[model samples]
Every structure is written in C-alpha cells, then in structure tokens.
Target: MAGNRAWILKSRPEGLPDMSNFELRDIGAEPLEDGWIRVENKWLSVDPYMRGRMNDVKSYVPPFALGEPMQGGAVGKVVESRSPHFEVGETVFHMLGWRESAAGPASAFNKLPQMPVEDHQWLGNLGLTGATAYFGLLRVAEAKEGDIVFVSAAAGAVGSAVVQIAKAKGMTVIGSAGGADKCAWVRELGADAAIDYKDGPVVKSLLAAAPKGIDVYFDNVGGDHLDAAFAAARQNARFAICGMIENYNAGPPPAFRYIMRVIAARIMMKGFIYTDYMAEMGDFYRDMGGWVASGAVTGRETIHEGIETAPDAFLGLFKGENMGKMLVRL
Candidate 1:
C-alpha cells in the first residue's frame, strides 16, 4: 500500500501564521468506508480565505480543529470507490486538501465538469475564484454595460477574472494591483486602466484612473482598497465585498476614514462567499465557458510543486507572491 502524508494544524495562528503552526505527518492508510472513495490528490489550492478558517472565530464556516488535517480545495482522481456515484480513475474536486490521498463520503466530492481546460483550472478560474468574480460583479454589484467597474488584486485569480468579465460586458474596467508588472497584466486582461497602488496613494491613483468616479466596485483586498473605492464611488454605486485579504491577519477590522461617504453617496455594499450562488453553477459555466472559449476570460495560476510545499504556497498568498491562483501540484 502507498504511504500517506497530511498537513495537520498544530496550533492556531497569532496574527500571521508560520511553519511552526503546521505539522507534516506520515500516517497509515485507512481502508475506504462503505460509502466513500479514496482519491490520490493531484492538486491543492491555497487561497486567502483559508486564513480565516485557521482562527477560532465564528464565521460562515467552522474553524480548523486542532491536531487535525487541514482542508481547502483539492483535485484528485479516485483510485478506489465503494460508492455508486464515483468510479475508479474518475477525477474530482473536494475540500479534503493538504494531503497526498483522501477518503471521504461520496457527498464530499464533486466530479469535475468537462471543460476544454487543464485539470488544475478546477482550483483556479473554473472554481471558487471564478465564481466569486462572476456573481459578485454581475449580481451583487449590479454592474452593467457602460458602468465604470473597479477591482482590487487585479492580477490575482478573482480580480483578473473581474477585469475581463466587466470588459466583456462592455463596462469600463479599472483594476488595482501591487506593482507595475501586475498592473500591466491587468491592462492586458482588458482592463481600461490599471492602478499600481504601490506607486503612490491608492486613492490618488484610483481617482486618476477613473476621473469621473466608478459605478461598481469589486473588492478583493479590503482596507486601503475599500477606502479608495469609497472615495471614488459615484452616486448609487454598488460594492461587492469579496475576500478581505488585507485584514485576514490583522487584529481587528480596518477603520475606514471614508466610510462616511457610504451615506452621502448611497453606496450599496454586500459581503458574499462563492457558495452563496451554488444553484447558479450551470448559468456560470454556460457564460464563463463561452467566454473562456472565445478568449474573453483567461485563467492564470501560480503553482508550486509537491504537497510538501503546500505551506509555502499558502503563505505566499499574503505576501502577494502569487500572480493568479496559487496551487500546489502533488
């Protein structure tokens, strides 16, 4: 039998996490249960949202249990199955991540939908990241044709998608990223303008990009980005609150000085998770698939090799080390 290895949560984080908080353990492979499948994990996703799950705070999802295997998004192929819904050699997406192999109930896994893309795309543009951009921009923000749309983390996975989707929908898109290289990539992704927040004051750069103010804001990195959007929002503008990566490791929520603008501008803001729109997956695939096929939307990724490098891949997220989706290829 093949040996198995998993990354265990050794301790809760204090501000920022470190290698000491995680433990890589070798364990005996347990037999598959009657209604479960055993999968050889091929790809593991390390997203910004996973940071919240490490804290012992109450949120939409439960925190990671101490001394247990960590979980995120993973793609794998079933090697053995005791469930009718799955078969040997079938590729799947599951939440049992940070491990080389996994055995879980059939309900915990979903077969990857057929797409003219690579398998790892399931953890990037075709997965949660894409969904976050699609629904947040189109539904939550109510962005429409000719609307001025602004997205933060514009070269990252969800932000890049937002840049493209808004442009494809006829909206003038302005994206904010860290450096000149990322900003240039955002423009290449079809954003009308790309703001390099590292250059000067974020608000000043954003105002320069959209002089008339913006109608929709797709927020990925909160904090200064949120304040910038608030400062540059036009009347009746809508904001979709996605991942707040900036504040993930902070002690408390950022005190935005421009929050008062919400009342004066009547800026509509709503926080959301990708799971909130699961029923619309079919609609998402139809539109996103078409866009992908026509080169209207592109999924980019930053991948690290081996399951052992999963921790580094995850830590790189906060450091802005990833270009698009950050994944570990096992």
Candidate 2:
C-alpha cells in the first residue's frame, strides 16, 4: 500500500540533484510486521554527503539504491511498537528512510534522551557534522591560539559550528560565505571577519581579509575556493580537508598545482571522516554541549517544512541557501 508521502530517488544524477531526480510517492501505511515499530516522522536532516551517495560507484559507504526510498538522518515519534524495548509516544533518531512514516526494529533506532529538539539533534551537530569539524580542525589542522582561521561554507551546518568552536578556543576566525547576508551571519557567530565568496575572486578577498597569511584552513568548499585558501596560507599552515561543497554538484577533479604549495610552504593538509572518531564522542559531547548551553558556543539551522520539500531543501545546500543546519520539518 502506498502512503500519502515519501521522497524516492527516481534517478541518480550525473551532476547536481534537481527536483526531477526525486519522485514523491503517496505510500500509505504498511503492516508493522514482527519486532518492528512504526514511527511518524517529524524532522529530517539535509546534508552535503547526500550528493556523494547518489553516485553508483563504491565509496566509504554504499550508494543509495536507485528507485528506492533515499535515507539520511531523521527523527520521529514511535506511534506503534511491536518490540519490547520501546513504547508508544517515544521519540528517536535513526537511519530511517525519507517519509511521513517508517518501520524498523527497536534496535535500529537510538532512543533520544529528554532534550529540546535542538539538543536531540546533538546526534546531528555533535554527531557526524560536529565530529567532522572537531577532528578536522583540532587533530588534523592542529589549531592553535591566535591562529588566523578561515572556514568556507561558514554559515551552513558544519561551518556555523566551526566558527564558534574556533572562536571559543581563542583563535581569530575569518569566514567565507556565498553572499553579503551570510557574511554578516558568520560575523555575528563571532568570526573576526567574513568574506563573500560570490564577490569575484575569493583568493583576492581572502588575502585582503587575512592580510597576514592564514594559519589554518578548514575547507568545506573545494575547487577554486580551496585554490584561494592555498594562495593565502602561511608557512606551516594546517589545512583540514572536510567537504568539497563547491564541486560536489559538478566538475572534474580540481587541479593539484596548489597542493604543491602545501609542500613548498610547509603546510600540513589532511582529510578526515567523522566515523573514524566516534570513540572520542563521549568527551566531545560533554565539552561541546556545555559550551552550547553556556552560550559560549551556539548553532543555527534553516528548517524547511514538509517531507515533500526535503529534496529541494537538500539541493539548497549547493546554492548556499541555508544559514545554518538545514532540516526539514515533517
């Protein structure tokens, strides 16, 4: 039986994900079956990694099956349970498919501790994206006090969090965003300055903003933007290769001449994935959650209403349409 709403990947894209790549199916309820709980979806996260998942090649993760429900991070309330561990009316987050409803084993979901939806989304912030920033900046970039740090995608989910976290650690933060408004948003997040990447030649602007060569580069947008960061980095600078949002929607692999700058300038460049550091999360959650509660660290999110619009919301990340974390309200 088809329900009223589910976003299915009608086809994978050769480049950007447009509305035509997805099909909204009106799937009604399916039987709970044994040992399964049926959850009414409430919120879903739209992230950059979803772009890579659309490809047919093997990667660190599996490709999303074509013509099936595409899945990402989601939260929902259990309306019915056939398992012993969960009861009705409990909320949880899981790798559930995109829809108005989902069914899975109790073990398939993690029970959300009592907290605001924002806090429950710690699974999102302090979860994958947070860990990405944490390990990337601290361990890979080797962030130090008084370092001049530049982060691309500075107003999106991970970038917003990176600005505050670096600020808290006593670094001078400069951010790069797609527009003037997002530039202002990043400055409000405590970055010392924010450059608009859209304003022609990010390299020239970044060089002008930092004046002194950049000590750390947290690259969320690669390609030309990364090329710019390289031009501005100081000797022995640290580069944390996080995501390449700029080129994710299209393009050939970026040129590597700039990477030679890393060796010539003695810059340290490293790439990291969050799943590699799940073991250190207990400590990060305690430290970072405290910073958030104390107002020392803050996060922002752009919420799009309705599961039907989730694809549009996700596609928005490529355009810098979101200010902070992007979520879809169900």
Each prediction's RMSD over C-alphas, in Å, is 1.0, 2.2
Alpha-carbon error at 32 in model 1, in Å? Answer: 1.1
Clashes of each: 0, 5
- The candidate that wins on lDDT is 1
In model 2, the runs with Cα more than 4 Å from the true position are 1-4, 28-30, 116-120
lDDT of 1 by residue, 1-330 (tens): 468999999999988899999999986588788999999999999988889999998999999999999999999999999999999999999999999998989999999887878888888778888888999999899899999999999999999999989989999999999998898899889988988888998999999889999999998888899999999999999999998888888866678889999999999999998899999999988998889889899878898999889999999999999998898999
Clashing pairs in 2: 2-27, 2-28, 3-26, 3-27, 3-28
Candidate 2: tens digits of C-alpha lDDT, residues 233-256:
898998898888777877776685
Looking at model 1, residue 194 earns an lDDT score of 88
Error of 2 at 83 (Å): 3.1
